[model samples]
Target: MESTTWEESVTDSINTIYLLFSAYLVFVMQLGFAMLCAGSVRAKNAMNIMLSNVVDAVVGSISYYLFGFAFAFGVGDNSNPFIGSRFFALADVPNSTYDYTFFLYQWAFAIAVAGITSGSIAERTQFSAYLIFSFFLTGFVYPVVAHWVWSSAGWLSPSSSDLLFGSGAIDFAGSGVVHLVGGIAGLWGSLIEGPRVGRFDAFGKPVPMRGHNATLVVLGTFLLWFGWFGFNPGSFDKILVSYPDAADQGNWTGVGRTAVTTTLAGSAAGIVTLFGRRLLVGHWDALDVCNGVLGGFVAITSGCSVVEPWAAIVCGFVAAWVLIGLNILALKLNFDDPLEATQLHGGCGAWGLIFTGLFAKEEFVIQAYDSGETGVTRPYGLFMGGGWGLVGAQVTEVLVIVGWVSVTMGPLFYALHKLGILRIPVEDEIAGLDVSSHGGYAYVAHRDEGHPRYYADYMRLQDQS
Candidate 1:
């Protein structure tokens, strides 16, 4: 009896430790995001970029907690195929220790994925509009898609999914759900907001907006890389080595394997991003080096669990190439995705999802190791001879999300433009968001000798609205 009790205690402790670590890593990714977006924008906009990240992180968290928690996870009567109808306002959640623990852990994920879109809209969006968008996404869109995969009754769930792909859509780690949703939204958002003023001339010759500080960008990139281990691997329930044969898990193998694949692919992305940048540009750029590491991790997320470590390397390398290309194309298209969210998360994420269909190993599938599947339904990837059906499913999902967000968001933003609520007034845009929106300055204005400063601060401000 004592031995059994001790084992149970060990399992409980392990669960807590894993959950805590994962939560920490995910939470810190926000800082990486802040720094990344900040660096992408001009120095004049740095404070505004950081402030938006901070606000959305806070706002997204509260909204997800208050209503999203239950709607995404609360069980239904046999589980609904579309929306999670049970936990409407987090009312059904109990006060048990597990309930609170589950809430906190899941909350971190909601925050990370929801905030991913902010990078795309960093400089130009209205602060008020962004706050509203974050709440709606966390409370409704992000959660609903999350349920479609993670919830027992969600339509994407293998047990109940009736899609043409018998095993359901194959976004093993939210490539289709989280990254794509944010990417599509970011694309539409950038389009509606339009290219930043002075970003292009009448001929559309691309102009470069050099980032404020490369040092901050590098540090932020490191933080994101550190956090992803927890983000991908921690999606699994915590496993206890002492209770290797416990009902929850047969071993710690899944988590360990996931970490290996995640890091390996990230490494591949780093090298490929390095080479791609060197070959494509005059030299390997620091910004590419920083984001290339991230590009790898994002590319590997979908297949991290199923692919071999070396396959991860290959996937990451390919994804790095994709990311760099997308960034270049984005400039040509006049899409001002300042932080490259559309590339790093959306482009690489899509690549990762498709790769999962190609490289997943057979034994890995049969091991009942996919924490995403909740066991029961085992689907094969291309390497395992599953063929093109799963790939079709993944494509369908990407279209569904992109098409849905575009249709809904495009018009909404256009209407806001008409109403004059989308972008701030021209004067405010010239003044910078820190002073106009956040009511503060991000940096000490340095003196420029012999440079006459515009004395607009003393002039009465006029509201465009």
Candidate 2:
């Protein structure tokens, strides 16, 4: 008995350390989001967007701690399918089923949702409005969705006693719960705010308001790619459990396979986008390639653990076209999103869910959802002959996510717009939010030295001109 207890203790310790490392890796994605936003916007608005990204993490931390986590996973004997009902403010936390490391990992996911929305309304949004919506999103709107899909008590959870269509939604790493929710919320916000000032011409023609730096976009993309290893494989939440039938194999194998699928999906999408854009626009664009890579990642996130690596490649390949097609539609509709947050996360994210329903392997599903212990077989991929139940569940998830986010975030943005605080003033936007609102540029060419030399040189140059 004592030896058994010691073994369990070691396993628990190892699992805790694994979760903590993954949480730290996810936290690094915040930096990636900041850099990506900074490079995607014009130089004049770089400071504004980067500042919003910083505030997203800070505000998300407090709100998720106080309310979001409770709403997402808190449970009791009276647990309902719609929401969590206990553990507010981290009370009674570190319980048998969850620990502080779990909270940290979840908090990282909460902030990522907010980060996605920030990219949609990047340059022309009010900072005060950003704060209000960020808190609401992290604290209330997003948590409800998380509860529906992730919580054990959730109706859509595979672990639920009563699963949706006897399978529930296989959002293994939150293609719908995180990416779709964030992307749909962003869609509403962008629609209400309309396009950025110069994004469309007078006759409704599209204008290419290119970002100032391609180097930063590339850098941010790579950082996000590195962070995704943690985002997908880490969702397993544990690595010590052994499969029932497999000898000397366990969740560790699934974790490694998840990582491989993530890599192949993103790589395939990037390559496809590179060539696709060349054919479409007659140019090799690095920015488009980067966005395509992210779109593929978003799409495969739902099935990274359950789908084969080859299926992941197909997911990414289709995801590239989905993103490209959405971009074209956005342009035609005169809808401007600086980072393509809605299309990449929202559109490709939806595709990812469907892909899971179509390609998820039965054995992998049993391993991931049932821990390979339950003898009961569950519905799986339609194309794999597992049947329509899982695909139906996947479709249900997509519809509900779209409906839920639209219902919640749509009205909030509309209310802010009615109050005249949703968007920045025209003059502030025209002069750039940095100068008009933030007090300085992100990069300064000349600084006042408390001397006449700089002023005299400036005056001479002005006179010459």
Highest TM-score: give the candidate number.
2
TM-scores for candidates 1 onward, in order: 0.88, 0.94
lDDT of 1 by residue, 1-465 (tens): 435487677767778777777878878888888887777776667887888888878998888877777667767473365667645655656576545666777777787765778888777778877777778777777777777766666676543536447666656567767787788777777887887765777899876666768888988888888888778887665555323234554436777888898888888888888888899887968888777888788878776777788889889889898898898898788778777888888898888878877877765554434333333455567766877766676666667777766776667667777777778765666666776676556776611110114324322221110
Off by over 4 Å in 1: 1-6, 77-79, 159-164, 241-251, 368-377, 446-465
Clashing pairs in 2: none
TM-score of 2: 0.94
**Cα lDDT for residue 216, model 2?**
91
Superposition error at 81 for model 1 (Å): 1.6
Candidate 1 backbone collisions, by pair: none
lDDT of each: 0.73, 0.89
Candidate 1 to truth, TM: 0.88
lDDT of 2 by residue, 101-142 (tens): 998999999999999999999989999998999999998888
